[model samples]
Target: MTITYEETRELAQRTVVDARYPNINIYTLDAIWVLYDRVLRVDPQRIDDPARDRFLLSKGHGPSAFYAVLAAKGFFPAEWLDTVADLESPLGSHPDATLVPGAEISSGSLGHGLPLGVGVALGQRATGHRDAQVYVLVGDAELDEGSNHEAIAYAGAVGLANLNVIVADNDSASHGWAGGIASRFAVNGWSTATEDMHDHDALYRAFTAPHPDRPHVTVATVRT
Candidate 1:
């Protein structure tokens, strides 16, 4: 079954677990689907393969999209989505790696995904696994977390070419950067690309670009 963005987005809408925040962030989901479908090199059937790509959701608060993509990609059954946030369900508002079939790490609190992704990328390299890549998704607001800065700087310094970060820029951050988010990663020796998250072709090109001796960051902007 081929999955289009709209189809997966509809599945995401069905996974809404909270009533207080009722709207699904379709912008974020659209960006993620493009990256996952076009750039990620992981097999849903061989999810546990040591050489498989890793995808982590740093902006875990808005995870309906991730869950939908995972299920649509066959990481788990689509039926599980309906039980989200139920006491007996593993599909909680925030994903749990141990419980959820495709989650690489359990995340909800901000600022952890990039650091963990760096570690995973480094480990994959250190273990002689050359083909694997690590992709971490973060919110624009998550840049305020000092830990992300450290991870960005460190990943750049070490030249983790296999590590990639996607920052969903919705202008939600409390504080702003002068040169924009891509500059932060660029100055730290990472390759940076900025594009509209809804532009699938541009996103695919950015995600698949060559970043020799450095990490890669794609600043995907959405409407404010």
Candidate 2:
């Protein structure tokens, strides 16, 4: 049975640990939900399949939405959601790939996910997993890291067609990019799309759009 979006939201709400970060995961809810629900080609039953698509959450400071979608999609039991951030729970404020079933990377530090994603995509191509795709979700502010800039430039230069990046833009960047976020990736030779994060159809189209010889980026603008 496919889980409804409302059910996923309720599952996310079940993970109430820190009062200080009450709404931390809200901004990413829709974007993650759409990926798990419609775009990603990962199977909960065969997580270790080499051909499976990879989704890395770079903005892992608040992963309630990620956890909820994983549980809803059967990556883990829903009961685990209730114990998020607990001392013994595998689920934490920042996702750990070693602990979480569907998590591809142990990410919490900003600006690391995109670079790691580039490596993963390169590995997949080298390993002959030509059809596999690598997707990385990053916060707008996280792009301020110099590592991501290098990754972006390298991915474009090498024409990593299987690599995709989703930037959750809530207008939170410390040093905003000129001509908007899409322009940053566009200038680096990447295919770019800007869409309202809340628009599921638009997001799906952006995620699946063809980028023949280069990596693609979708800047998902959301309400701050």
Best by lDDT: 2
- lDDT, model 2, position 43: 95
lDDT of 1 by residue, 172-224 (tens): 89777777999999999999999998888999999889887889999999976
Give the distance in Å from residue 19's predicted Cα in candidate 2 to where it truly belongs. 4.4
TM-score result, candidate 1: 0.96
How do the residues 1-224 of candidate 2 rate in per-residue lDDT, one tens digit apiece?
87899999899887764557776456788888888888889999999999999999998888888888999999999999888888999998888899999999998888889989999999999999988999999999899898999999899988999999999999888777767999889989999999999999999999999898999999999975
Model 1 — which ten-residue stretch has the worst lDDT?
A: 18-27
lDDT of 2: 0.90
Q: What is the lDDT of residue 32 in candidate 2?
A: 88
Candidate 2, RMSD to the unseen true structure:
1.2
